[model samples]
Target: MKWLGVLLAVAVAVIVIYKVNYPSYSYRYRLQVSIAVDEKIYTGSSVIEVVWDCGPKIAGLGRCAPSLGGPATLIDLGAHGVIVATLRSGENISPTPDGAIDAVWLCASAFGYRSTNEELPALPHLTGRRNLSVSNLPRLVWFVNPADMKSAQKVTFLNVASVFDPTAHFTEAFVEITRDPIVVDIPNKLPWFSELRRLQKEGKGTLSKSGQFQLVYNMFVGENS
Candidate 1:
């Protein structure tokens, strides 16, 4: 009886340690991209999931880290497409008090270099910080290649649209961020099975809804590739 009690205590301690160090919390969002070439537009979207794991700190030596999940192929414009565009979400994860995402770094780039061997001019590129909680939802950020502008100027949220010329030789890009809801379904297997069954009993089981930020962009390619 004493040996059985000892084994049970050790098993309980091991479970507690595993739950503390191995379990992870995650935040998910979607990234969508659209490119316009001539009269047709090509669009694609992918889910961006960030998982945070709290590591065991050995004398304060270890730190928590975040892992990102998404499709390996972001989007394939097409074989005959004139423009190539990409959207990337930063790995920096900082959640708000209400468990929502606070802010994230977003970067977008669009160019027409893939379709031609000719050395094209500078393309549209932008990297900026987006505040999700306090800022207005569905905010738009625009970018224009410096080669298209006659005068050198910085693009801001208010004056970015003015810099873009519809008849330019290069491509112009516009990125927007919006709040969308996503449903996360926990699988009934391994460590999550017990938690899933518990939630199932409360009618909150298989699926849980969470907020997601949809980062969508539109890139317009001019004729001169």
Candidate 2:
């Protein structure tokens, strides 16, 4: 009787511990994007559907494209709409490199609101959402109408990656620029935003308002096949 009682106590203790700790954990997000192409004028709307924590292996995913890190604009000029979504899994990584894949290139440009002549703030950021806990979708440089001034926008240059490596494939799903706002999911709360912003405040990123942020380096945004 004593042995049986001890065994039952251990089982109860294990069950109680698991039940109490399980609720504290958060779930993963499975991002799914839907793209539509206009084919007539190279523009459209993108529907991004997301499913949480549904993955076989998280790292096994690929860059937006099979090889191209992502998109300079991420919009398929041929298609009207584009969708981008991410998933979470057990440390997924691509096993094979797509023949059409290329390195992620850092590109830059000036931002300004055309009609109002309002310029954007040059804020420094840690980069994409890769490992961070939260993703940040900042406004990119572009022209907008005065009446369209909804928010004081800020965005540096966009890093455009080519999948074709000047010799392969470059495919876009689809999208509309003026209408479709830039929506990028960064990692959770990043560790570098505060410091990067501090640099921006200290005028360390660039001295001139027009002075662009220099290309720090090309990060390998590679995904497994």
Q: Can you give the TM-score per candidate against the true fold?
A: 0.34, 0.21
Stretches of candidate 2 off by over 4 Å are 18-23, 26-30, 39-225
Candidate 2: Cα lDDT at 103: 19
TM-score for candidate 1, residues paired by index: 0.34
lDDT of 1 by residue, 1-225 (tens): 999999999999999888665554444345454444444555544443434455564656345454444321122334431121222211123432223221122211121122111121111221222322222112222212212211212222223234432321212223233234432221211123345445555766333122322221111111111
| Span of 10 residues, lowest total lDDT, candidate 2 | 99-108
Query: Which candidate has the highest lDDT of all?
Result: 1
lDDT of each: 0.31, 0.23
RMSD of 1: 20.1
In angstroms, give how far residue 89 of model 1 lies from its true place.
9.3
lDDT, candidate 2, 1-225, per-residue tens: 999999999999998765443312111111111222222322222222211121222254311211222212222322112211111111113221111111111110111111111111111211221211111221122112212212112222122222111221222221211212323322112223234435655667422222221211011111221
Q: Global CA lDDT of candidate 2, please? A: 0.23
